[model samples]
Target chain A: MRRGPWLWAAALAVYAFLYLPLAIVVVYSFNDSRLNAEWVGFTLHWYDVLIHDEEMLLAAGNSLFIAFVSAFVATLLGTMAGMAIHRYDLKLLNFMALTPVAMPEILLGVSLLLFFIQVLNLTLGMLSIVLAHITFSIGFVAVIVRARLAGMDDSLFEAARDLGASPWETFRYVTFPLILPAVIAGGLMAFTLSIDDFVITFFTAGVGVQTLPLRIYSMIKIAVTPEVNAVSTLLMLLTLSMIVLASRFAPDVLKGKT
Target chain B: MSGPPFVFLLLFFVAPSVIMVLASFRYPGEFGGLAPLFADTQTLHGLTVETYEFFFSDIIYGYVFLKSIFVALATTLICLLLAYPLALLIARSPKKSRDLMVLLVVLPFASNFLVRVYAWMIILGPQAAFSQAVNGVLALFGMEPVHLLFSPFAVLVGMVYVHLPFMVLPLYTNLEKHDPALLDAAQDLGANVWHRFWRVTFPLSLPGIFSGSALVFIPVLGMFAIPDILGGTGDMLIGNLIKEQFLGTRDWPFGSTLSIMLTVTVLLIVWLTTRLAGRGRHYA
Candidate 1:
């Protein structure tokens, strides 16, 4: 095919736009001076500060805690739902499964807030945030697990059943092993999303329960600082590394295959 | 799926959203929160179209709403334009290259979305690397450095940059499934490259385009942080407005009404896009 110069130029421009900011962020994180524009001598002062910053460390820990717990619980429920939907002929189940994905975050956050505040008369805090995270995280896990189940050969399960295996035994010995990769991939995706979430967490979080994104948001509102750049650079690297690892080991799972 | 999952959806997703709709219709309290839905005549009977009227009639609000829609539309258009070629490239690339490209795209999505937007802040702000670079280059031409951050243009740039991957992945998947022999047959039939793309490739990629647009447009409509950080005070979008009503002004009734309005508008647009795409498919 004869390639156009204009096409290549446009693609390169877009790719640059997508990446240049991130590159700048990473570059500036190591600067000795706080001034973002000027190139100062390279130093690890900001990272050292980040290491000792107790509040930021605590917020990061809280975020990790919430993400893992929510992802684990959501994955469990998602696996059950995936098995049930695939093994049976359920009407309107697909639409129900897709509802959380389709609904806007603001809508979900507000409604969940109202339910907790008005009906349940419960104080908003980490539990509310975890509950909110689980609500959407489950949908993600279900989508991936269900896709895996669809690609799976059902005769294996039938054969297990025919060989004097109970339904639970069939699931434990055959079905579980087959869909495990998808479940792990989905769980990692969910954890990343839960950690990254700002809007839903903002609505549901109570006073003094700051996640990392919330902390960053507050800092951004106060001022744009090199510290935030440092934080973002580290986060971007961590997420990119995890995603690369997942893509390497489990390409089909990440692509929504069994 | 059968009983429990359905019940969970009904109780959580369906019921809560329905309550939000109902809450929008309720009267405003004296303190500016939502009054009782079944309040007395003094409150409920006096329910007016005032909020909607205010939103539509005020030039600032109207302009902000229009600009947001325009930004979202421009973002979607840019994403489509960029994604098509990239998707085509990935689809036609060697298998290893395709995997590498897919990994590149998926990496950004897995990261913190706010952090990525924050990354743009560092690059576009007054003291940004680009600002310095541009200032240096422009000094040769004898011009001062131009302001880039805290502007509508910056917001549009951030929106498009962040959402580009969403558009690319779907288009790549759909385009990858197409048989290459069709393109070869078109070439054999004496169709030029441009004609082949317009008549054969473009129409076949409509589903992917629709899916990508849906993915980008809906979330961009409800986005708050991107505009807040990059857009600054004067460049408020609908998301900022909705956030202000809830947090700043303590006007839950008005905020709920605005939420309802935004939700309805998005649903209408999604329906319209799908219908238009369906028509395009049929005609093509």
Candidate 2:
């Protein structure tokens, strides 16, 4: 069947719609003028301003710290959860592992906000932010690891067991080697998610703490500035590179198949 | 194996959800402009339905929810319109080109959510070329130049833009599975392109459409950032309202109450869509 010209045109238009705004943002970041209304000349003024902004730097520090810690913990728990869901037919485990993934961010954010201050009496700061990040990140890691598990050959485990290996030895010898790429990919994914997260971090990171997204949010809320644009461009580049690298290094894991 | 994740989730996810439910029922203390936490033993002990009653008593909160529903519905529809052609094209494309097309869709999504929204703020801002050109047209008609930023239109645009990928990915996944044989069979039966698509391909794509709708609709319903950033005076939705109750109003009970209601709404929508999609698929 002939794919018509209109189909191509429509798809192209959609692609443009998806990209044009972002392109404009990137272009205007170096526009050499405060007013993003018109481009006068290209300059690195925004990046200069961003570099000098201490508050923004501090927020970036907090975000990176939170992301690394949460991603590490979430990966450990998620790898286990993923293994359990795939190896055993535990409905409860499946539900627990996946439900939070499906839950809306705002709901999770608000609920955790309440949980921290109201019940746990945990001060909302880096610790609270890390906990919240882990809560959401676990589901992501679990999903990726589970996807990797689903594509594996079950006979490998059976063979290990037949060789008189204990369960731990079987896992250590067989599963760990097979799923390492996915574990790393999932960890990277969890890291990306934790860093990019805005809604959850917004709620959990009380008055004192500020993450990059939170800082960006407050800046945009006041009004758009060149520094905000510069930071956004940099952030977009950061995440894009991470995802590209993750997918590149873990092609099979990214594809959820061997 | 599941013990660690289960315990972590039970503490952070399930416990918070349960607390949110309880907090909705528990009384709030008048605090010094902060979330009225469990103030005293008596207030904490009592499970009063005052917050729920307060929601039911006032119509404004209900109106905000209705408006949110409307915005979410509209955004979903618009996203479907934009996403369908793109998804169909990608699904039909050669295998070599398909990944590139999908990556294009996902690349923009890889950017921070706030950055994505900020892109629109610039596009819709008065001084931007798009907004200026729009106002220029309005000037020709001798009509009042409209403020595009901080308006419902901007909010809607931001919502659709943010969510278009969600709709596309699911639809593409479904559409990619359709057999060429079915379309060929329809063509041989004297059905033209439109009829073949409407009868066979479209019906087959219902499951995809429903899943995409659920994906788009639920997130839009609870989204506060787009509306908060783009909306003018009259564009408050349930998200904005719930956000205010917690952050601005500092009323945790009412905020929790609103969240419970939002959760129920999402659950209801997802359940209904599944049932409806199931029936539609059976017929298809």
Candidate 3:
């Protein structure tokens, strides 16, 4: 189609649509006004308020902790699943790992909430949240790792097996080193996904546990405040850097292909 | 290697889904959750398809389900329209700049999505400049000012904003793969740009469009937080209803039933879109 006049305007408008809400957010994070409805001279008062906000700080801590643990477990499982699928062509494992990521977040969240309360009788708190996070995150890690594996030639593993090395040694020496970048990138991707996740975390969180997204949800629901904006800005920065790092580790992961 | 991950998924993912199905068939506990399931009372302990009956008993549930579908479809259409030009521009850019452009489209994580939605809350608040400007215009016509934050318009804006990138990425991926020579051939054949696009570009992009629509539509179908934050009281969707069962009303059975309905609806839509898109491609 044409790229000269109308196309550029359309593109500009789309960009504005995408960025304006965020610009409003970032701009208001520093706004001095309590209402956050308008700009009333720039100040870092909201940041100061966020710094002192105990509940917000606690929620942030919980989010970081959940992201760390869930990402670790999910990466481990996902890397295995990725390798297993690549090496053995396990379709069931393939579906199980990937479907959670693809399915609507609420379905997963609701199902987990039911499972926790009914079957396992697990207490809904940090462990429940971590387990839930891991469930969804494994798919992402498996996708990246499997992608990395698929791009590789089969000869490397064949060469290792041809040597005197055992299966464990072959993996430790060859496969581990080769997919480390993808694995790291996958873990980082999982980290960001876990940290930014809201819908899944919402249902599984029960009544006691509160993550950053949950806190922000409640805050925004109750009333808009610059502190929420401040927290959102900082959380965005945190996840942004994590994404950049992930991409640096494995550029194709950001493009999201196998 | 497969044993561990497979076992983990069976325990967590698959089991939960199965349990949800079971829960949907059972009665809601007198208190909430599983008290009634495990209670010594025989009647409450007995499994029934009552939740399913209750679901179809009233047209209200079906109406909400249908509304959710309409919302999802509208959101998908709007996202496709908004994302197409941007995706095209990115796909058409110089190779070096394409990555940067795509990254920019995906970069709003810098505000995170919750904050992104909250940004709308602020902008559409009654006292905010955007709302005031809108209301000021309405005032010129002697119409009543609307509460923009808790309205359907706010919900749509939030939905379109959050899901735009999903549509953009898929289209960009597809558009990037198109042969420029095809467009050039059409041009040399005296086909206008609009003709070229409508005939060639769009037909080829059906798969991308379906995939993107699935990515957007499926999620929006189950979204609760957006409507919770941005929509009015009457703006309840399937997501909010399911949420209400589990959280608000504490009716786990009904909630699970609603959830099952949502899952089924999502699956149906996915199946339909893929089939339609597949047929479209065959014709193309």
Candidate 4:
């Protein structure tokens, strides 16, 4: 059977559709002209402007801080949940682990907003954002860790136990090392999701606490700017690098066979 | 650690959602806000279908609901068509190339979704590069530049661009697990490529396709940002409508009711898909 030209053309078109807008953003970031239409010449003016922009800098800092702390907390909780579900024979525990993923972001955001506002009477800020982020991020981590744990050989733990290790010691000496890469990968993914998230953050974040996405959304609402193009380009590069590194370092774990 | 997480979920996840549902039942009184539930029998009278009726009876609301579904369905279908070949290509490529392709595909998702959508606005807007290019091409054909932004076309383009990866990754995973030798065996039996694909490959890959469709369709149904930016003033999706009720109109009860309706619809689709997939192993 002949391989048709249509198939290859279709694939190319799909790839172009998926990537062209992003490529345009990156290209325009370097365009000397402020307008997205005309490319006068190449310059680093946008990057220079971005570096001097304090608000963008602050938002970037907050985003990084949130991602790092939230990812760490979610990883710890998720690891425990994954271990409990996989190691123990509790069916209900497994169901509980899966519930968060099933819920909509809008619902989750609204509820968290209400909970913080009405019940706790706590002022919304980075703290509430981090807390809300961790809620969903943990579910993602648990999913990845559970997949890794399932594929792992149980005999490794058995061997550690036979060597006179306590359960904690066994996990530390045997299980933890095996799943460490996956845990890290999961953590990276969680961080990415947390930072990329908008709907939830839109609700949970306070009036003063504007993440980069929130800033971009507001700016877009006003009017599109070349500065936004520049910022998005930088963000796209950072996120793409993280995802590529994560995928490269932890290949088999994400493949769902551990 | 064991019991505490469960309690946390119950309090944070479960309880809040329950409150939102309960809040939907309370009526806004003369004071123009959510009134006390017990104080109003007129509001809580067993089951009041007034909210549902109001949503359904209004022609504009009904039109928006149908349009949202159509847009979502179109986006899902486009994603499916694009994803299948890409998945197959990734599956067949060398390991390094395959991994690179997968990374390339997944990497876009890491950037803020709002930013990505904003990027699309630049690309599809009146003065966008694509629009200019199209105009240039049209000038060659002695035609004029056409308005593209603030149209359904723009919304669909943004939707498909944003959600394509969600469709691709799942399909790739399922396709990656396919046995190459099975195809070879089919070839040996004198089955043509199309026949082999229809008889073997397509059936095995249906589960991924169904899942991909569900993933793409459900979220796009409630998508707020893309429609708001790309769609015309007349285009109001259910998500935008809900947003108006909650924030613009300050009608929490009506907003909550719409929320419940949307949530229920999503849950039903998920349930039906999973159930059908379970029964049909080809799809599953």
Q: Best to worst by lDDT, what's the order?
A: 3, 2, 4, 1
Model 3, range B1-284, lDDT digits (tens) per residue? 99999999999999999988888888777778644654655544768898899999999999999999999899999999999988888888788988888888888855567888888888888899999999999999999988888988999999998999899999999989999899999999999988999989989988888899999999899999999989999999999999998888889889989988888888888898888998988977
Candidate 2 Cα outliers beyond 4 Å, as residue runs = A252-258, B32-45
B1-284 per-residue lDDT for model 1 (tens digits): 35665666666667767766665655666676566555766644345565777667778876866777887898899889888887787677767777776666666666577778877777777776676788789989999777888888789888888888889888888888888899889999999988989988899999889989988888788777788888868888778888887767767656777788788878899999999889877866
Q: Is candidate 2 or candidate 3 better by TM-score?
A: 3
Between candidates 1 and 2, which one is better according to lDDT?
A: 2
Instruction: Tell me how far the alpha carbon of residue A55 in candidate 4 is from the true structure, in angstroms, after superposition.
Output: 2.1
**Cα lDDT for residue B161, model 1?**
81
lDDT of 1 by residue, A1-258 (tens): 433666567656766766776777777888888767778889888898888888889899999999989888777776667767777745466666666667557767777766666556679888888888887777777777777788878898999999999988988899889988878877887787788889889888978699999998988788776787788877877777666665553576444223
Question: Distance from true position, residue B43, model 3, in Å?
Answer: 4.9
Model 4 gets an lDDT of 0.78
Worst 10 residues of 3 chain A by lDDT: A1-10
At residue B96, give the lDDT of candidate 4. Answer: 72
Off by over 4 Å in 3: B35-38, B41-44
Report the TM-score of chain B alone for all candidates. Answer: 0.90, 0.95, 0.96, 0.89
Q: Compose the digit string of candidate 3's lDDT tens values, residues A165-199.
A: 89999999999999999999999988888888899
- Leading candidate by TM-score: 3
RMSD of 1: 2.8
Q: Tell me, what's the RMSD of every candidate?
A: 2.8, 1.9, 1.5, 3.1
Best-first order by TM-score: 3, 2, 1, 4
TM-score for each candidate, following the candidate numbering: 0.92, 0.97, 0.97, 0.91
